[model samples]
Target chain A: MAGKKLSIIVFSGTVDKLMPVGILASGAAASGYEVNLFFTFWGLNAISKNGMQAQPQVDKNYEQMGPMMMKRMMDMKFPMWHQMVREAKEVGEVKVYACSTTMEFFGLKKEDLADFVDDVVGVATFLDRAEGGTTLFI
Target chain B: MSQEAKIAKTLDVKGMYCPGPVMETAKAIKQINVGEVLEVLATDPAAKPDIEAWARRTGHQILDIQQQGGVTRILVKRAK
Candidate 1:
């Protein structure tokens, strides 16, 4: 066993937060920790293969806050969020589980999602793996 | 220690989050070989948890880590 095994429960719909989830998981994979990331609710965007999307904070002013902000951040060398996720798969053995309950509601399947998903599991299955470890609700 | 022995390389990865720090650490660790070590400095607030997690899954050895000035410096040894 390592120092501590950690689990993160993601419930966000935006790809931005989901991107970080991958990065965090990647970092754990790199560090040699056992990380189980549970995707529930809107967090499934992380494994969406058809195309992942994120909406920036809308600027009500007469400025191009959305595009400008995105460009500025990109110009500043913010790594493409998706690249972090892709690299995570390459560098480590990460186990990504989708919420079976949520998938049932959405009528989604492993084949329907991107190739990154490890498996589809229910809350009890996730809890079984997450026993006696740190659980993060993101 | 060889003349070219690593004194220490502190990589500050604060604003860059998640895989950013993880990927950066990977590249940095790659530059050095087995004997040499890498000192990772991060301020992402999630660095400790993330790095510790990376260590467990990757089979790499972490020499030590210390926090000062709100930055955690992780010393990692590349495993053969």
Candidate 2:
């Protein structure tokens, strides 16, 4: 088996993409790979305590289902993506970093995010850590 | 079967969304030894195709996929 470090750059603000970003990072870690998730722009919103409970970002499927129905679908705990991200972190070497530039632009503080974030850094700094293995953006 | 010697992990992900069951299965498979099998019990219509794709792309193998009622039981073998 090939063991490699995986680094993911998360740029989307919506919860839909953000959830997978975290899940994959955690999954990679659980599979015995070192994993890091860099959260930038709206993607940083996913780590907030409130974000966990908030409705996930709507997608094309959700759009077809309509808001009321989609809300119901989300409420049913079908996938429970948020909880997966949380659990994945608990069991793996997943680290979440907030993009410093995004934070500054939004006039947001790291404290404003949910409980999963580890630090705030710039792209240059994140790339330095992501130099080897696989890199993904979500 | 004795819990300790069960030799397999079962993840019931019937209603889980895209990437949800797949992610969980991947995580569970990682915990077991190389030859251990992972049985992902999913009701999600997407699990069969998505997991098959993931397994194929990642070098893992799908031992079997059985659909009963609306749920599908996908047995996967971790890549060595």
Candidate 3:
């Protein structure tokens, strides 16, 4: 049988949501699955050079807990979400894509994204890569 | 259990979480020769199912799994 595939469409920028993207991608990648991460809208912004280093923000509903959670993660020596993605790439076939439309909308160049981004692609390309796989939107 | 199934290396990933144990296992598996067993010692609650799933997907064989004092020990034989 062919190997399993996992595709994630990242649309949220909040740290709460982005954490799952990184964790899920890493989990699937570690399991020898092909992983594709399609970053769009706020998600595209999160992967940008500036955004990757920006302070992590939680959803408005969880704003009060953000600082405590960050502190707890720091105390536990937890890896940041981006670090997880990088580790996933090291262990498995993981491809990260930046949405072309989102880049144009935000005036972002290819270089504006984090170094791990494999390509700037459109929705059609994302669909093609995500076909016959388990796709998630985060 | 048998001499032929002896573990070649032991990867201790205790105190690590989800992907940490799995990622370490993937990397450690590469250091052993084909047919050699790689033993993983982890504390992550997900280690058992996660490593089993990883072995399944990677075409490796999981020879044994045991837990004691909250530590999980997994034996995986590299298939490729």
Candidate 4:
């Protein structure tokens, strides 16, 4: 299992989609895999300091069940998705990258991103790190 | 193999799901010395298979597993 890696191109900001990102990242890290999370588009918003403070929203299609699902998750004592990703970083070689292009488009500075973000990088840099491993676009 | 292994640490990951159990198990295994046994008590149904796979991948050894009522008890020995 030497040098095993799992890379995710996070494209969605919705809670439903982000949950799996945290779960998979943590799981890979726990299993001794290097995990890379490249946040782009809406996913980049998810790692912003302001974005982290806002209430998490599910997809509009699941709006009716959103409240119920949130309550159920709370009842089960599940950690928030971001918390899981943070834990992943604490336990293994997990790197969270914010997309440079997205940051420029949104006029976000490095300080606006979450503290956990390892770097603000371009597509080529992300591709180089994500090469030769399991890369998922979510 | 008939004798019981001494438990050095016990981790109760009852309500957590999926990665929680395995992650905690990985962390707990490090708290004890190599060759020491860890007893994990979990309620998640995936605990058995997940921990087994974790052990296999991490090179740890699973000594025994048992289910009583709703709880699953797994005994794993640190092999590294």
Judged by TM-score, which candidate is best?
4
RMSD, one per candidate, in order? 5.8, 5.4, 1.5, 1.1
Cα distance off (Å), candidate 1, residue A125: 1.4
The i-RMS of candidate 3 is 1.4
For model 1 the local lDDT of residue B58 reads: 64
Comparing 2 and 4 by lDDT, which wins? 4
- lDDT comparing candidate 3 with the true structure: 0.91
Docking class of 2: incorrect
Sorted into a CAPRI-style docking class, model 4 comes out as medium
Tens digit per residue, CA lDDT, model 1, B1-80: 22233534666686776567776787677677776678888877777776776666666677777787877878878775
lDDT of each: 0.69, 0.70, 0.91, 0.92
lDDT of 4 by residue, B1-80 (tens): 43688999999999888889998998899899999999999999999999998888788999999998899999999998
lDDT of 4: 0.92
Candidates, ranked, lDDT = 4, 3, 2, 1
TM-score of 3: 0.95
True contacts kept of each: 0.52, 0.18, 0.55, 0.67
Residue range A28-127, candidate 3, lDDT tens digits: 8878889999999999999999998888879999999999999987876778889999988998899999999999999999999999999999999999
The CAPRI-style docking tier of model 1 reads acceptable
Candidate 4 lDDT, A93-136, residue by residue in tens: 99999999999998899999999999999899999999889999
Task: Note the B-chain TM-score for every model.
Answer: 0.80, 0.85, 0.93, 0.95
Which pairs clash in model 4?
none
**DockQ, cand. 1:** 0.36
